[model samples]
Target: MRYVGWTILITFWVALGAALHYTLPQRDVVRIVRVFEERQDLNDWTRIFWSRPDEQSDTFISRDVQFLQTVRANGRPMVYRNEDTGWSWPPYFKFDTSNLFTEAADATSTRAAPEWYVITHYGWRNEFLTIFPNAISLRQVDGPDASKGIPWVNIIILTTIAAIFYAIWVRWRRFRRARIDPTLEEIQDSWEAAGDAVSEKRGRIRRWLDTWKAK
Candidate 1:
């Protein structure tokens, strides 16, 4: 039972971390190799990775999605899907998909004269599932060696969440200690006092019965 409890606790934290990592915005420094558009069938399970440009049109099952191909600093190829998040999850409010595609196209460079870019995106790429991270924005940088500073957005978000949980935990402890614990203690003391009173009454009755028998 102890082992099972630990396993469940660890699993919950791991799952929470993965969910936050996938939903939060992340940045990648890479060289834009190419930009293009492709028609995608959104009727499958992979549709979750895609976006709904029109919030009211739930019947549309397929659409054309723009893509940006890039090579990371480690010489690994990475692809990003350019789509408008609209008023959906992650809340990027990205309605400039077309403009972003044009910018990515203009930033495209070859291996000889590599133009590096800092691509701001959110989501994950799973080769087996054919899901790519959605590129939220992009900007040209000096080179592949350019320093993409720390993720302040993620830091702030995580810090705020931690603080909220901590506050709740502290309040709960105070409530338990100040109100709940004292009430339980009072109830226990009253029950013990009543038991003692009943025991004393039985002892007095036995003493009275012995005196009558002696007479």
Candidate 2:
């Protein structure tokens, strides 16, 4: 039982961490190599990674998705999907897809004259699954090494989650103390009192029988 309890606890935490990691916005300082629009078939399971730009478009299985190709400081290639979240999940409220595409196109640079830009995005890149992270915002930086800016967004999100959990725990403790524990104590006291009353009745019956036997 103890082992099972520990395993469940560990699994819950691992899943929570992975969910936060995938949902939270992260920064990647890289050089934009190219920006292009490609028509992608969104009929399969990978469709969840793409954005829904219009309500009527949900009927279509394929659509054009803007992409930003970049090379990280470590020379690894990274691609980001530029799509408006449009008051959807993650709540980025990004509707300026055209402006973002324009900015990315203008920011394109070669390896020799690398113009570093921080891409603020959320999601995961899995080549096997063909899923790319959705870019939320971007801004030019002085250089690739120039302070990879702090993740204030992630900090705020984590702090809020912690506060929520703390509040839930406090409420649970109060409920247990104020309601659950008191209820259990009352039940226990009633059981003990009933047992004592039964014992007193049994003693009186024994005394009455003993008096009859003596007579």
> Cα lDDT of model 1 overall?
0.89
- Cα-lDDT of candidate 2: 0.90
Write model 2 residue lDDT over 1-215, tens digit each, in one string: 99999999999999999989988888999999999999988766777777776685677788888999999999999999999988777788889999999999999999878899999999999999989999988999998787767888889989999999999999999999999999999999999999999999999999999999999
**Candidate 1 structure quality by residue, lDDT tens digits, 1-215:** 99999999899989989989998989999999989888877766677777766664356677777899999999999999998888887788999988999999999999998889999999999888888999988888887889777889999999998999899999999999999999999999999999899999999999999999999
Cα lDDT, all candidates: 0.89, 0.90
lDDT, residue 95, model 2:
95
Candidate 1 matches the true fold with a TM-score of 0.80
Q: Which 10 consecutive residues of model 2 have the lowest summed lDDT?
A: 48-57
Which has the greatest lDDT? Answer: 2
Report model 2's TM-score to 2 decimal places: 0.79
